[model samples]
Target: MSTSAQGPTSDESLTPVRWGVLGASNFALTVSLPGMKRGPLTQLAALASRDIGKARDAARSLGIPKAYGSYDELLDDPEIDAVYNPLPNHLHVTWTARAARAGKHVLCEKPIALSAKDAEALVDVQRETGKLIAEAFMIRNHPQWQQARDWVRGGQIGDLVSVQAAFSYFNRDATNIRNKKEVGGGALYDIGCYAVNTSRFLFGREPVRAIALVERDPEFGTDRVTSGLVDYGGAHLTFTCSTQAVAYQRVNALGTRGRLEIEIPFNAPADRPCKVFLDDGSTLNCSSARVTSFPTVDQYHLQSEAFSRAIRTGSPVENSIEVAVDNMRVIDALFRSVESGRWERL
Candidate 1:
């Protein structure tokens, strides 16, 4: 596919950044697409899929005005200012590179690549293209995570001690993409990424070492369950994630003087208030813990707006490719630990 640059428009400052969806993934349809439509600085311009019929149907159903039979066609559309890539893990790097070279900013799905080396390649592409490219980490855009980070940094949690988190869901469908080995399928690449990313985000530092244990499904050749520990020198993080278990998630940060607990940490509710519980360690009773509730907000919308504003104003994107590379390094170390049955230094 030939790459082309998008020309500047006279109304660029006044018009919203037109966005195209690279695929009709469920998450794209249910979350990102709706969020882009609601974003103040973004417009849902087009939808694309390998199948023209599917793209047209999705576009009509979602109220988007245009549809393309292939991702390359969508990338070539000069009217589109950016693209949201909800493609599978393996395709993230390739399509993002294509979109960047085509002069389109990219907001790609999480675990931007299967390995740190692969993530670094995307970082190089971002630098060479000089385009706004970021990993779609919506939690960082949520007020709840920002508040939690503030509390931790402001000494409300005192000297950081440890972080514990768990994310799980039951999905035994062998035919699902998540169950396929060649496409970067596994609990670690899927929901486990949140746990890893959150640990780094809250700690504000990379881990020095990591150890992990993973259990693979014999038929699927993908990890069904995984547990890992990351040693961050002064503090450590422990987390467990499973794809074949009941749906649930929670994150807790413990310090010498206090503790912070996040309910529904990873998959936060957009329609209702989400809460963070804090215990100052001064009290011996559970009732002394302070509860803070955040108003209902769509994090995906916030993410889209932030990206669009960055593209328009030349501001910094929140989840940059560099940060994604760091997260992937930890994930790579964890996988190495799993294979060697020993601690892997990052």
Candidate 2:
């Protein structure tokens, strides 16, 4: 799949992908657009929105060269080589397919689709277009995560046992996309995915089953809080994500001999060094702790660079659509478990 957008000609191998964003969502303006500018093989070339005024405003503020009144117009631009879809969660599949069919590689936002079945629809399109399509799970590109995985694999924690995680924030604004159920709003789809993705990342295996306790917002009809347990053979991962709660996040990975605590597990601050603590559990305190820090970096920039490199050099993607599908399957099972009041096999 990575080779679908085969490496460019010899002379074009080092060329940056002229990235055109589909919308000027707040996340795009405040985070992705700026980070995308720093990529080794990415360019903030254009931005488009259904509203011409919105697109032009975003383009001017971000110094993007072209602004389009419609997504189709930007897709038709000959100089553009890739597209980033930060549209609402519900639109990820439709827009990604459109971008691919228009002869452009695509990097779409997380929760690539509302369901595993919806995500599967892209497989045929990807194969048919021979285009590189990747979900934007920027965390996978962070060096801290890589280092954490290393410690797990290298036995720094001595045989991974379980991963305990929690991510939450108070957001009740009915107007916010994260609160709109029809467009795929909810704690599970928005943040619980990190728990599933990273546990799978560290376990290096799929979970055999899953179960969850979900609490929905009466007004929004969306899961405001969700806690799920996944069984990876003999190992386990317990995580809770919330859309309405005190703002906080952390992840702890425990093993037979030691444990690792990721301080800023999900929303890693880009302006400062990221740290992870290792504890041997000898004293049950800080005395047995070791600290590891990674220099300041924006995960989004790294994500863009990796995808662009894969496009320009025929390299592998850090996380592909197949990975997204597996993740969705776990999430799908969790949702079913809520209804059935029992564990659902993955």
Candidate 3:
């Protein structure tokens, strides 16, 4: 709760921001943790989990200097300037609020809350503490997405007409957290959020209404597949996501004069180059499409660096709590539409 508008320390202005992880989730281990270690703007200071042994083992294996038995201990560490919350969807808001109250900036995992109302509560916490809290939407930091957004905004794709996207992965494990409804598990809450977020990001606005159809798994009580549509005035966004299908993802944007396609839309590879395909209406064959390949870049590193810069300079982040809330509002409407069998206004 140190709400003082103090600037970064003189040394910290030249050094990396000391960062801690709230949990030893696989994503933190494989993606965010490595990103922190590699990024010049962040220091992998510590890690904490409910199980002390696991925390210690992970810290040792990851070369982190400190390990805590509890998340509170990590948050209370005066040396840690920020904490990454890779907890479950339901725990995102709680731990993020705690981190902010402990005078630490937060880069929380996506779908920052299960609902719009909960997202609003987190926004309130940010307002009260004046801390730099951002939902960890790493796609926003990817060069592919940045270029796509720029092209769309720069009128390279002409007037936007529609967006079509799909994301799926086969995960049949009954005990997986994504299969548990109580923890905010579902196809929509998992991969579908990315599709929705991408649409909103490229469109640069929220939908006016939404409709969705979902099929749930009987044993897991989680949506196995879902298809949704969002009305954005003259333009529309359509997406389908599934947990029971083959792993695949693609996003295409259609406009009056041309189209934009992302070959590796959501799960971008960090070690290999990724391409964005653009096609002007002048050509009739697939060979007419132009390809732009981005070099090997770790988006998680970019995200961490962006958050660190915001904390160091008191600047705004790309994925603000308000953006999360708006995304959740569209998600809430989609769920309502699925239940009511009609379009739900946002």
**TM agreement with the true structure for every prediction:** 0.94, 0.95, 0.95
State candidate 1's TM-score: 0.94
Q: In candidate 2, what are the lDDT values of residues 1-346, reduced to their tens digit? A: 0111111222235987899999999988998778888765788899999999999999999989899999999999988999999999999999999999999999999899989998888877889999988888888888778888988999998999899999999999999999999999999999999999999998899999999999999999999999999999899999999999999999999999999988998788879888888889887757778877777888887788889889988888877888888889999999999999999998
Q: How well does candidate 1 match the true structure, expressed as C-alpha RMSD? A: 7.1
Instruction: Please give, for residues 1-346, the per-residue lDDT of candidate 1 as tens digits.
Output: 1111221122336558999899998878887777668766889999999999999988988899999999999999999999999998899999999999999999999989999999999889989999888999999988888888888989898988899999999898877889888998989999889988888888888889999999999999899999999999979999999999999999999998899999989878778888888887667775768888777877888888888888888878778999999999999999999889999998
TM-score of decoy 3: 0.95
Ranking of candidates on lDDT, top first: 2, 3, 1
| Candidate 2 regions with alpha-carbon error over 4 angstroms | 1-13
How many residue pairs collide in each prediction?
0, 0, 0
Which regions of candidate 1 fall more than 4 Å away from where they truly are? 1-14, 282-285
RMSD values for the candidates in order, in angstroms, are 7.1, 5.3, 6.3
**How far is 129's C-alpha from truth in model 2 (Å)?**
0.9
lDDT of 3: 0.88
Candidate achieving the largest lDDT? 2
lDDT (tens digit, per residue) of candidate 3 on 1-346 = 1111111222345568999999888878887778667777888899999999999999998899999999999988999999889999999999999999999999999889999999999888989998878898898888889889989999998998999999999998987889999999999999899988999999998889999999999999899999999999999999999999999999999998889999998888888888888889677775768888787777788888888888888778889999999999999999999889999999
lDDT of 1 at 81: 94
